[model samples]
Target: MISSVLVANRGEIARRVFRTARRMGIATVAVYSEADADAPHVAEADQAVLIGPAAARESYLVADKIIAAARATGAEAIHPGYGFLSENAAFAEAVIAAGLVWIGPPPAAILAMGLKDAAKALMIEAGVPVTPGYLGEDQSLARLQAEADAIGYPVLIKAVAGGGGKGMRKVDAAAGFAEALASCQREAAASFGDDKVLIEKYVTRPRHIEVQIFGDAHGEVVHLFERDCSLQRRHQKVIEEAPAPGMSAEARAAVTSAAVKAAKAVNYRGAGTVEFIADASEGLRPDRIWFMEMNTRLQVEHPVTEAVTGVDLVEWQFRVASGEPLPLRQDEITLNGHALEARLYAENPAGGFLPSIGVLEHFRMPAGIRVDSAVEEGDEVSPHYDPMIAKLIAHAPTREGASDRLAQACAEVEVWPVKTNAGFLARCLDHADFIAGDVDTGFIGARLDALAATPEPSDEALMVAAAAALGDQDGPATPWRDLTGFRLNAAPETTLRLYLDGRPVLASLPQGDVEADVLITGDEVIVFEAGEAYAFSARAPIADLDEAAGDGQIRSPMPGKVVAVSVSVGDTVTRGQVLMTLEAMKMEHGLTAPFDGEVEALLVSAGDQVSEGVSLARLKAAA
Candidate 1:
């Protein structure tokens, strides 16, 4: 039996593993970077070890350091909680070589399924259906172009080692095939250190379905059913649920069998996910499903699989690592109802979903739902990691009930100071199309304009703001009286400037009415009358309000090291021109100018570490 285990990852996954391990009487160890010294994962562990600096390359990606931490902590095994080096065959090999049990599939299985082209070949040999594509080893540009032509138009160019849609492109026309291939190759090389790619026939209007499979050392494997992750952004899953909606009995059986075949072919063990793309335009059919990829470790969206199945996947990982056989038979396992999960990110949806970083001054999530988070109130959202604050999951007897409960829970969540996707998620759950289960990968993007639209402040909230401005509370030296300049006889109306959504809004406070006129400069007064004013309060700023706003310059969107600077000082650039690039959370984000302007100053150089909202370049307004 494994007495102690070191989780070789950080953030929510680490916390998640610790929770399960603690319940099973297993001591848990946490490894963290310098930036995560005060992170919640550190607090949740039985022992914490510093791996390295904040950059993932120096910290989580350093397999040797993680191994050393495990050794130092006397951990009997290592649980790689996805991402970083979770699927890295070398890391698994190293852990086994170090005499510590590896709580994942064998290195051979990981190597077999690590590359998409190779995995598809293996799956084909295993009698599993794979999407029609060119998985040949030819690297010549002309050869790929020829293959693309032969495969017909509307083909997908994907990196052999890709996941999360990074080195993938959809070419709708033969004319654009070469350019898309070049772009995909460049990104593939930068992201995965491999530029080898493959082409596949694009499945139009597809639904992403994946099966959860577990294997034991005794050659016993079982399927834990399926998850619908059709709701995506940039090919990254945003929402997921168990027992995919609208799935026919025949289709489910086929997918489950194929998932089992894929795992058995690799002699797999522990938890793994077999992802498939189904042609939903023609409705789900067994023949329409094709293998996408196999995630060799636990997925971030695995909680929903746990919810409906009543299986602790992490506990299973622990048990399977101890050489346990299959605990439950296929006929014994059954789904109960429906469950949904939403990723709550510290990002501003209206601001292009750029990661938001700041101290969570007042973080409060709703009860009666499972919230797996690695941070707490007063925790700082660093740019050194992924901006996901938490994963909120709700389970009910029906999909509609689950969605409705999740929406209500999200509305009651309060995360002040740091902007979040909570409001955006709430809007999505309440969306008519979403409620009716008529959603696709393009749903968020299609309804983005309406989803990101911030609602006007309620009358009650405005009244609270007015009360805060007026100093009505019993206290010494009223600031409102000071603003009125000590007028004795007549109560004077005063104009004051306040910041809202990074812009100035003029508020006029009159003595007679308990409300204020929210005046739009050079426009009209939007009258706001008080309704229920009890639950409203003024929100404090995250940072010092008196600080100058960084010279009105475009800054890095998240905490990251500057990878490149595309523009120089005094360079004339148009609106949306790329100025620089910053990389964080293993993803690259480009910083662009807001409008046509001349670069006035370059504040940061390549390789500089920057925090969120730190100015990278200053742009002078166009004449």
Candidate 2:
């Protein structure tokens, strides 16, 4: 029996695995890098061990280091949370060879499904449906181009070992195929250390659905229905839910069976996910479903499956690792209700979704909802790791109710200092297409303009701000009243300027209670009147206001080393023009000019390590 387990990853997944292990009376151990020394996962475990330096390649992905940590802590098993080295076949082999139980599928299973091209071929041989495309051995530029031509336009060039859309691109016309392939290859090489790619037909308006399958050493296997992960941004899932919104019974059954067959083919043990792409333009059908790939480890979106199925998948992983038979039969497993999960990322939605890093000053999530977070209020969102702060999940009797409850929970969640995607996620839930369950992978891209519309401040809210600002000073009489000013016949109208979402707006208050004209210098507002004016009192900086505005310089969006400088002092640039690029979290974000103006100063240069909100450049006001 496996008495102790070591989680070989960091953050929420480690915390999640520890929770399950503790429930089963199994001791849990945690391994951390230098940067994650104070991370919550390390503190949550029964024992902790330091592996190596801060870089992932030095710590988390160092198989030998993780194994040594497990050995030092006397852990009998290792659970590799997804990403890093979870799907690494050699890592699994090393763990088993070290006389530790590998709490995942066999290495053979991982090898079978690790490569997308290989997985597709295996699935086809196993009688599973696969999309028509090229999975040939030749990877020459000419060969791939020919495949694209034969498959027609709108082909998707994808890395054979890719996930999270890191190494994927869609070409709408043959003219852009070569450039897209080059870009995809570069990203694939950087992210996965493998540049080999494959081409497939890009299904327009496709729904991403995947089945959760669990297997045991005794040859028992069962499917846990399906989850819809179609709502995506930049090909990364933002929202996921169980018992997909508009799934047909026949389609669900077919996919579930195929998932079980896929697991059986690989002699898979423990938990795995079989992903499928469904043509949603015509609605879901059994014939429309095609195999995508399989995640050989526990998934980040597994909470929804647990909520609806009433099963702790982590517990099952431990049980199977202990050489136990399947806990429940296929007939006993059933979906109870609807469940939804929203990823709370430390990213700014209005600012191109660039990852935001800072010390979370205040973190408050709703009480009733399930929150799986890896960091605390005082914890820092480092540039070396993933930007996801937490996962908020809600379960209800129906899909609409679950979505509504999740939205309410998110609205109440407050995380100060660091900009988050909370507001944007709430907007997505309230979106018409999403609420109606008529969304696809292209939902965010299609509605980018509409969804990014900024909210307007209400009269009451503005009044509150003005009142707070006015009450802060020490004056004989009220600022709006006549005491210091000389003339009684005419009261002076004061002009107040404030920044909202990085843009300036002017408020003009007349002497009396009559309405005043307000000028919004930015784009139009959809939810409220942007330029409408109201009676003013004063203004004060609230907790939500950007603290960096007082610094008089534009800061980097995330923690990263500056890669390039586009301009120096006295150079004029327009809004949306690239200022510099910061590479972090395995991605590069271009810092852009906030407004059209002359560059006053450049604070940093290439190769300088900068934190989020560190001043990088300054823009002088336009004449």
Best model number under lDDT: 2
Superposed model 1: Cα runs more than 4 Å off: 140-146, 149-153, 171-191, 471-499, 502-553, 564-574, 577-579, 596-623
lDDT of each: 0.81, 0.82
Off by over 4 Å in 2: 470-556, 561-582, 590-623
Residue lDDT tens for model 1, 235-284: 77788888788899999999999999999999999999999999888778
Estimate the Cα RMSD of every predicted model relative to the unseen true structure.
6.4, 7.8
Model 1 C-alpha RMSD to native: 6.4
lDDT of 2 by residue, 105-141 (tens): 9999999999999999999999999999999999999
TM-score of each: 0.85, 0.84
lDDT of 2 at 218: 89
Candidate 2 local distance difference test against the native: 0.82
Highest TM-score: give the candidate number. Answer: 1
